[model samples]
Target: MKAFFLDAAVTLTLTAAITTMAACVGPGAEAGTVTKGKIYASEAAMDAPLYLYENNHAEEGGKTFSRSRYSDPQGKALVEEEVIYEAGKLKQHTYVQHQTEERGTIDVNDGKVYYVFINAKGTKTGSDKWNDDMLLPDMLGQRIADNWELLNAGENLKVRFLALEVQDNFGFKIFKEGESTFQGKPVVDLAMKATGFFVALAAPSFKFAVEKEAPHRLLKMDGRL
Candidate 1:
């Protein structure tokens, strides 16, 4: 079966990255300045639309943590998450289910990346050594932004990340449906379809209500299949 877990690739991996090297904010230095907020999936039919929360450093602008939750068709609660760049070159990931957790930790050694995964019982389940194909979420946004030419030209853009070699990366132009209100603010209705390698078979279409501004932060997403 093509598992529902594949949806997580769209949810978490959208923000994937090899955690960047940066100095940890000191306690006396704007430590609690993390801005936190949640964005919801905008589809009306979805009673359990995807909900995501991100904690971003107010001073640094990069995400510190991101969590997303949605219910599968079988009514099982699922969450996929990432904790980034805590102190050293370490990042944490968790995939949650009704009773089990698939957890992973990523670390760098001699400029090579590897990850270790464990089950809910705290037993080491698997590990990948010198893995080159790990998906980094941080690059996904920039990948779309860097291809503004194609986006503007109304092209079906093929997105590629060197580190995510095995994933299917594709995006399509979403016509402006109209104007709408989201979170008490005005937004533009734009639609796009995206499929990562893991969820390529699903080929989900996403609707976005974006701030009609220069750096449009997504106001809402309709990520229903």
Candidate 2:
């Protein structure tokens, strides 16, 4: 999240009810420019493989609305969607399944979940009240309760990885830190991690890269857990 037209973090929280927040990350990201096709790149976003290896970039700053073009296999102009990001939060769902289309190496809609950020445990961040949206069955939930690797026995923090329902190169690494609350009652922060394989699944052959490690990709988050 960069602070260009809007402070991504501040805007996100203020627009909490917007329901459509851009979730995005890059090595060194740029934005649309005033002059047609003008661009820039920061040193930091450039260093990360997520932005570097992708082999495409968008300029930061300048015109709020500008369009560039990247192509697809059938020579179609790819319409990239806006990445939804959050602040002081675990995961920012950039792509949602319900609304998405590619354009010029940019995603148009703000509903695509290519990646998820997790704490140490297996529970999802922020969202604690488990329900059908968790994509878990009675038996699977039992397995999670049984085999989860506990990082903090006191907080009941544990971790687990599972294959998805469709198995379409998509997965989430969870950081379950006991029970918390969202609207009310209790909930958990299941920060799911995704891989480049997911990118390709969403945008066939949509070249991308990801790095996994002790604390970078997989993390023991700074939470009560």
Candidate 3:
């Protein structure tokens, strides 16, 4: 299956992985910047959250570390993920699905991406060489930040993204959609779509709301996650 971070192309089960990755903060992590957010079914119907997530970020020994936990509305942990970055890029990621006891890890080494998953079915492993512009899910925000100017200038940004399920990389594009208000705050709307010929035909586009000012914090996202 094709996956582009928070894009709707991913299956519902993969949404858990997407949220786990997005909740990760980039390098220059701080200890007290923990934040919590709710995942709702839709923007208009916010009566209750389908799931709640918590993010804790920290810096240790020159590496940025992030831990994210997702829970049901009744407060039972569903999935938990830990991610580490070195020099502002993803180093390794591990996640656990509490209910199924399924666990997996993604590692980058010597220009290659490695994945290992364990479940009742058995242990599965896969690897593929990655390009310099290839991004792990946690790096999506930083990528957007790095290309902020181009996006604001109405330029389409293209990059490769790692799809953990397939243990492969796929091309995707990001561009500015327009400007709008989200949660009463001024924001810029951005859209992401798969760029590969076949994937593009089937993959659904995704939307994001980012703060208009400097730092350009992401205010909201609308996708399968």
Candidate 4:
């Protein structure tokens, strides 16, 4: 597979991962034998679940999506993010809040990644090209590989695998706070500190819950940005 890196001039650091609620459905879904539009639980002991499989949206060559509304210190709508994916690849990602608005696409082929950025007005602004020498030659799959390596190296589970959408001059400090239950399933809690040059002096924090199984899906996530 082709291996590429961010151009040296681009010094931004960002990490990305899917955050969603897990719901088990379909026949034999409890045993991870998914059929049709269902998510099956895995019985295997997974250090980290495969990214390709974790994506409920990518499962059918269709779109899986989520959206969030951000609020200001005064509890007013400030920004919003609508994350979209198709067959495990990010098809369209949009973030509009405050004065910052961006829309972009992430594409990976044969180990090479192409990141194209467009402004809110729908004009191409910049693009990045890179390669990964790990896993399947796809963006989401490569992230799963990277995250597994980090987990094996004892990296904190709080720090999620980087996604192309969020890779721009930012630092993530993740803390594993404790354990909890989501939808009656066991989960681990992670607190994230997002800090970067473009971010304000007061960095925002977010919370995440990960399933305690092989795939370690994001059971639920809630935060105020």
Residue lDDT tens for model 1, 8-114: 11221121111120111211123343322222233222344233333333223443443334444454554444434443233444444434555455444554554
lDDT (tens digit, per residue) of candidate 4 on 161-203: 2243444223455556777886677866666565454442444
lDDT of 2 by residue, 1-225 (tens): 211111222121111000111222222223422111101122234332111001123333321222222233233433222322122111222222222221111121233223232223332312132222222111122223333444223233222221222222233333443444433423333333234465335423111011121111111111110
User: Which regions of candidate 3 deviate over 4 angstroms?
Assistant: 1-21
Better of 1 and 2 by TM-score: 1
lDDT of the structure predicted as candidate 2: 0.23
Model 4 clash tally? 9
Which stretch of 10 consecutive residues in model 4 shows the poorest summed lDDT?
1-10
Error of 2 at 209 (Å): 13
Tally clashing residue pairs in candidate 1.
Answer: 10
Clashes of 3: 0
Clashing residue pair totals per candidate (backbone < 3 A)? 10, 58, 0, 9
- lDDT, candidate 2, at 211: 16
Name the better of 1 and 3 by TM-score.
Answer: 3
Scored by lDDT, the top model is 3
Error of 1 at 34 (Å): 3.6
For each candidate in turn, the TM-score is 0.44, 0.20, 0.83, 0.41
RMSD of each: 9.7, 17.3, 5.8, 14.2
Question: Which of candidates 2 and 3 reaches a greater lDDT?
Answer: 3
